[model samples]
Target chain A: EDQVTQSPEALRLQEGESSSLNCSYTVSGLRGLFWYRQDPGKGPEFLFTLYSAGEEKEKERLKATLTKKESFLHITAPKPEDSATYLCAVQAYGDVTSYDKVIFGPGTSLSVIP
Target chain B: DAMVIQNPRYQVTQFGKPVTLSCSQTLNHNVMYWYQQKSSQAPKLLFHYYDKDFNNEADTPDNFQSRRPNTSFCFLDIRSPGLGDAAMYLCATSRGRTSHNEQFFGPGTRLTVL
Candidate 1:
């Protein structure tokens, strides 16, 4: 069975703090790994997509790195605006029933206190 | 801008009442999906339409149903919403039902059961 898990279900960081969130997964065949940012009362916003081990992508203050069995989202100098739930999802080359199912992790809730 | 659009940013319904949530996309995508997200949890897949080919998840309840009238519009109907059904209903779209296609999401409809 394919599964995705994230560490530190909730994190409270002061403004400008730097930390990392972990996303570990077990899949039959990894096709893509995705990261999304979701705010309260809103749907998730697309962030980064990592396709292979050693692949990384970065935005303003966020960087995502992928590995064979896990992925990491590193936040650099995070601000209060960066406070949101971060979600990790994986799409694998599934069995005959479905090929495009995207499995999502429980997500990490981050609170950047000012 | 090409985007996924969901209506009724917030909805309040009585328990055991039927309600419908709607979504439309201008991205001209071939896939539309409905997800149920509770507080501090990952968005759970309810069902999806891959160009009119409806696919339901194995664990989805029978009270939930969906319809895709055209390439751009989709609807999710809950026959009898329970208090446990109060959640954020998210609508998402992808270019195609492929492993590499990333999903774009709408702001989501936050359902409140009374």
Candidate 2:
């Protein structure tokens, strides 16, 4: 069975504090890994997509890196606007029956105290 | 800008009443999806439409149905909403079947079942 897990269900940080969130997954074949940020009362916004091990992407204060079994989203100097739930999803390569299925992990809620 | 758009950011419906959420995209994507999300939980895939083909997840209830009148418009219809169905309904779109395509999501509709 394909499953995705994220650690530290919630995190509180002071303004300018840096932290990292983890997303671990077990799947048949990894096609791509995605990171998204969702604010309260809104849907998720696309952040980064990591296709292979050792792949990384960065935007502003957010950087995402992926490995064979897991992915990490690193945040630096976060602000109140940056505080949101971070979500991760994985799409498997094979299994046509499961195509278009992107399994998501429980998101990490981040609160930046301003 | 090419983006996904969802109408009625907040929806209020009485218990056992029917409701419909609409989504449209200008990105000309071939796939559209609907997901249900509760507080602090992963977004659950309710169903998706690949082109004109409709696909439902195994655990999705029959009360939920969807329509894709054209490539750019999609609708989610709930025959009878329960209190448990009061959550955020998100709409997402992807370019094609390629493994690397990332999905873009709309702002989402917050359904309040009274």
Candidate 3:
């Protein structure tokens, strides 16, 4: 069965602190890994997509790196505005079809205290 | 700006009552998805529409139905609401079937069963 797991369910970090959230997955065939940020009572916003092992993507203070079995979202000098639930999702190649299903992790809740 | 939009940011309905949540997209994407998210949990895919074809998840309940009237509009209809059905309903859209395509999410509708 395809499954995605995120560690450190909740993290409290002081402003300007650097931290990393982990997303581990077990799937048949990894097609892509995605990261999203969701604020309270709102939909998740798309962040980064990692397609292959050793691939990395960055935006401002956030960087995402991928591996064969897992991915990491690293936050650098995170601000209070960066405080949100980070979600990890994986898409797997299924049945040699055009449609691949995405499975999401439970998400990591991060709080940046000022 | 091309984006996904959902109606009724918050919805209150009585148990066993029927309710409908609407979503529209300006991105002209080929696929649309509906997901139900409970508090502190990952969003669970209920169904998706690829152009005019509807695809339902295996675990989705029969009470939950969806309709796509056109390219830009989709609706989620709950025939009978229960307390357990209270959750955030999210709408998302993507360009095509490739795993690399990023999905754009709407603000979501918070459904409250009273």
Candidate 4:
């Protein structure tokens, strides 16, 4: 069975603190990895898509990096506005002829206190 | 700006009653997805529509059904609501049926089953 596990279920940081969230997966074949940020009472917002190892993408103070077995979302100098749940999902190579289903991890809840 | 829209941010339905949640996307994306999210958990994929074709998750309940009447609108119908079925239903859209693309999501509809 394909499974995605995220570590540090919750993280609390003061303003200007930097940290990283981890997501590890066990799947047959990885097609893509995704990162999203969801605020309370709102749907998730797309952050980045990493297709291969050693790839990275950045937006504002967030950076996402991928490796063979895991992906990391690093936040630099996070502010109170950055408080939200960070989700990581993996798209595996499932049945052919159709795109694989995207499976999500439990997510990391981050709180940036000012 | 083009965006995905979900109607009735909060919905209240009685047990054994049927309820419908509506979603519309102005992005004209070829693929739309429905996800169910419980508190503090990752959103789970219930089903998705690629064009007019419907794809359901193997573990999804038969009580849940979906209809995509056109390219822009989709609805989720819960035949008989139960207390366990109360959660937030999210609507998302992608440009196509590709694994590399990021999905855009609406604010979501929170359902309360009494």
Candidate 5:
């Protein structure tokens, strides 16, 4: 079965702290890995998509790196605005004629205290 | 900006009552998805529409039904609401079934069953 797991269910850090969240997956054929940031009472916002191992993507203060079995979302000098639930998802290659399956992990909730 | 949009940011319905939630997208994407997200849990795929074709997840209950009237609009109909069915219903859209395509989500609808 394809599964995605995220560690450190909740994290609290002071403003300007740096931290990393982990996402591990088991799938038949890895097609894509996605990262999203969701604020409370709202939907997730798309962050990055990594397609292969060793692939990395970065935004202003967030960087995502992918590996064969895991991915890491590193936050650099995270501010209070960066406090949100970070979600990791994986898409697997399924039967071509069938719908591709995307599995999501229980998100890691991060809090930045000012 | 091209984006996904959902109606009724919050909904309340009585148990066993039928409810319908609507979503529309301006991205002109060919694929649309509906997911159920409970508090502190990952979003679970209920179904998706690839153009005019509907694909339902095997685990999805029969009470959950969806309709795609056109490229930009889709609706999720719950025939009978249960207390357990209270959750956030998220709508998402993607261009196509490409490994690199990132799904864009709308502000979800929070459903409260009473």
Candidate 6:
């Protein structure tokens, strides 16, 4: 079974504090790993997609890195506006003829106190 | 402007009553997805549409149904909604049928069951 797990269920950070969130997965064959930011009572916003190990992508103060079994989302100099639930989702190579399922982690709730 | 849109950002329903949530996307993506999310939990995929073809998840309840009459619109219908069915329903779209594609999400509809 393909599954995703994220670490540090909740984190409280001071403004400008830097931290990293971990996401680990178990899949038969990896297709892609995705990162998303979801504010309370809102939908998730797309962040980054990592397809292979050693792949890295960055946007503003956020950086995402992927490996064989895990992915990390690093936040640099966080701001209160950046506080939200970070979600990690993984896609596995299932039946090629049909659309595969994307497994999502429970997400890490981060609070940036300014 | 929101590329993906969900109507009735907040919905209220009585127990065992049927309700429909609407979603429309201007992106004209090839795939649309419906997900259910609860507080502090991951968004759970209920089903998705690849063009006009509907794919239902194995664990989805029979009380939940969906329809995609055209490429731009989709609807999620809950038949006999229960208290447990109260959740945030998210609508998303992707440019392709493959799971590797990044999905664009709309502000979700929060359902309240009485």
Number of the top DockQ candidate: 6
Question: What does DockQ give for each predicted structure?
Answer: 0.85, 0.79, 0.87, 0.82, 0.83, 0.88
Candidate 3 global Cα RMSD: 1.0
Residue pairs of candidate 6 with colliding backbone atoms: none
**TM match of model 6 to true structure:** 0.97
Instruction: Kindly list the per-residue Cα lDDT of model 5 for residues A1-114, writing each as its tens digit.
Output: 999999899999999989999999999989899999999999999999999999999999999999999999999999999999999999998785765789999999999999
Query: What DockQ class does candidate 5 belong to?
Result: high
What order do candidates take by DockQ, descending?
6, 3, 1, 5, 4, 2
Model 1 bad stretches (over 4 Å): none
Model 3 bad stretches (over 4 Å) = none
Across B1-114, the per-residue lDDT of candidate 4 in tens digits comes to 999999989999999999999999999999999999999998999999999999998899999999999999999999999999999999999986665357899999999999
Tens digit of per-residue lDDT, candidate 3, span A2-114: 99999899999999999999999999999899999999999999999999999999999999999999999999999999999999999988785546879999999999999
Model 4 lDDT per residue over A1-114, tens place: 999999899999999999999999999999899999999999999999999999999999999999999999999999999999999989888676666768899999999999
lDDT of 1 by residue, A1-114 (tens): 889999989999999989999999999899899999998888899999999999999999999999999999999999999999999999988678656669999999999999
Give candidate 4's TM-score: 0.97
- Please give, for residues B44-84, the per-residue lDDT of candidate 1 as tens digits: 99999989899999999999999999999999999999999
Better of 1 and 2 by DockQ: 1
- Candidate 2 clash pair list: none
Give lDDT: candidate 1, residue B18.
100
TM-score of chain B of each: 0.97, 0.97, 0.97, 0.98, 0.97, 0.96
C-alpha positional error of residue B47 in candidate 5 after TM-score superposition, expressed in Å: 0.1
- Per-candidate clashes come to 0, 0, 0, 0, 0, 0
